[model samples]
Target: MKRRAHLAGLLALPMFWLIGIYIFSLVMLLVTAFWTTDPFTSKVKPGFTLRNFEQLVANPAYLSTAVRTLVIALAVTVLCMLISVPLGIFMAKIAKPWLRALLAVAITLPLWAGYLVKILAMRVTFTDAGFFNWALAPFGITGPSFSITTVVLTLTYLWLPYMAVPVYTAIRQLPANLFDASADLGAGAWRTIRTIVLPLIKPAIIAGSIFTFSLSLGDYIAAKFVGGSTQMIGSIIASNINLNPPIAAAFAVVPIAFVVIYLLSVQRTGALERM
Candidate 1:
């Protein structure tokens, strides 16, 4: 009984935070999604209606924005994965200690800066007369000038550390003998990575992907600063949040649903356990 009491006391604050704060907020948001607004006064009222959801489904603009956001999220996740795997391998197994430390600092440096600061930095880089254009002008090339491509790149820059750190740690934890054994059997670097490294580190990759993907899905600030006229799911939610809050709430549920679906799909792989 004493041990059980001690465990319960230790768990008290976290359980309260999880249930009282996080879960309560989510429940409120879900409840708000089904609510209605007064047409004349624009005030929220206590009544259930599916009209907001219907609007989301019927509105082509909303549908397109959701699809575009999904694409951008997937693109960022893929880019992070592609870059992280090779970078992690080099940092973990090949780079000298000093170089590895330097690389680690470089990867995490962006996280130290403020979020808006990073977005503005990307904005400056891709502006019409910004560094990107100035540098590429000699080659007769030009910058993308704040398009969906720029949005994807900005998001990747912001979230790369989340993906890279885990992948690098996972790779570092791999038994060194696995590589030696594969080499002894005449397997090349690419072959060894394909057969061994990738399979072992997949959980970490998935764990990292969850962060990048969900963050990209819900981000509006990056798009607002560096996306030119690009619209994302968060853009719609922000626009409607004041003028039509029920619609905003309903739209907000889209990203939540996508994340829940993604978690469900990846749960079988034990990725959530890693997180």
Candidate 2:
């Protein structure tokens, strides 16, 4: 009884915050999404309506922005996985202790920098008169201007550490004998990884992707800094939040629904449980 009481006590605060704050906020957002905006006064009108959602679906611009946001989010996730796996294996399986520490530090160092600063730095690098263009000038290669590609690259740089660190940690926690056993069985490096290492690290990869995908989905600042005129779902929400809050709320539901569906789908794979 005492142990149960203590456990309940420990959980009470978090449970309150989750239910009272987070869930309540979501409820409010849902209610707000059904509201209507008065065009004459440009004020939010309290009511239930499907016009906001109908408009959201009917607007080509909004649809394009949603698709673009999803594409960028997916691109960032894939790019991070591509970069993390080989680097994580090297750090966990091969690098010396000091070298591993150095690599870990290198991977995490960018995270300490301000997010705005990083976006601005990318903006500078991708600009025509900036470092990237200057370096490529001798090779007669032009630098990429602010565009969807720039947005993806900047976001990938920002979120790579989130994916890499978890993947590296997962690899480190793996039993060393697994690799040795695979080697004894005549399994090559790639084959061992495909059969054993990859399977074990799948949970960690999913965990990292949750961070990258959700962050990229909601990112407006990076798009603002380096996306030129390209707008994302986040930017659309930002634009409408004050003048037409109902529409913003309606659009906000898109990413929220995407993330919830994604989580539910991956949960079936046992990724969330492992995390």
Candidate 3:
């Protein structure tokens, strides 16, 4: 009883924050989605209506934007996975101790900077007169310069740490004997990674993917600075937030739904439990 009481006390603050702030905001967003806006005044009113959701499907631009956002999110996740796996393996198994520590710091360095600062850095890097274009000018090549590709690159840069850290940690936790045994069994590096390392680190990969996907899905800032003419789901939500809040709320639910579906899909693999 005493231990249970202590545990409850320890959980009290976080539980309250979860229920009171996070859940409460989500509930409010759902409720707001069903509300209506006055056409003339452009003010939100408490009422139930499906018009907001209808607008989502009825408008082709919104549909395209949602699809584009999904693609970007998926691209970022895949890029992070591809980069993190090799990096994690090297850092955990191959790199010397000092080099490993330096690599770890490099992986997490971006996270230490402010979000907007990093986005601006990418903005500067890809701009016409920025480092990217200037460096490639001698070869008569050009940078992508404020496009969907830049958005994906920026997002991958922003979220790579989330994916890399966990993957590296998981790989580090793996037993060294597994690699030795795989080698003894005539497994090459690629075969050993495909058959052994990947399966064992599946949970960490899924966990990292969740962060990269969800963050990229809901992000408009990166798209704003580096995407030029690209419009994402979050862009629509931000635009309508003041003039037609119900629409914004409804659009906000799109990313939430995608994330929930993703979680459900991954849950079957027991990844969520491992996380």
Ranking of all predicted structures according to lDDT, beginning with the best and ending with the worst:
3, 1, 2
TM-score of 1: 0.97
lDDT of 2 by residue, 11-117 (tens): 99999999999999988988999999999877998998999999998999999999999999999999999999999999999999999999999999999999899
Angstrom error at residue 87, model 1? 0.7
Using TM-score as the yardstick, the better of models 1 and 3 is: 1
Q: How many backbone clashes are present in model 3? A: 0
Which wins on lDDT, candidate 2 or candidate 3?
3
lDDT of 1 by residue, 131-207 (tens): 99999999999999999999999999999999999999999999999999999999999999999999999999999
For each candidate in the order shown, give its overall lDDT on alpha carbons: 0.95, 0.94, 0.96
Order the candidates by TM-score, highest first: 1, 3, 2
Residue-wise C-alpha lDDT for candidate 3, range 1-275, written one tens digit per residue: 99999999999999999999999999999999999999999999999999999999999998899999999999999999999999999999999999999998898888889999999999999988999999999999999999999999999999999999999999999999999999999999999999999999999999999999999999999999999999999899999998999999999988999999999999988888978
Q: Each candidate's TM vs. the true structure?
A: 0.97, 0.95, 0.96
Residue 245's lDDT in candidate 2: 90
Which regions of candidate 3 deviate over 4 angstroms? Answer: 1-8
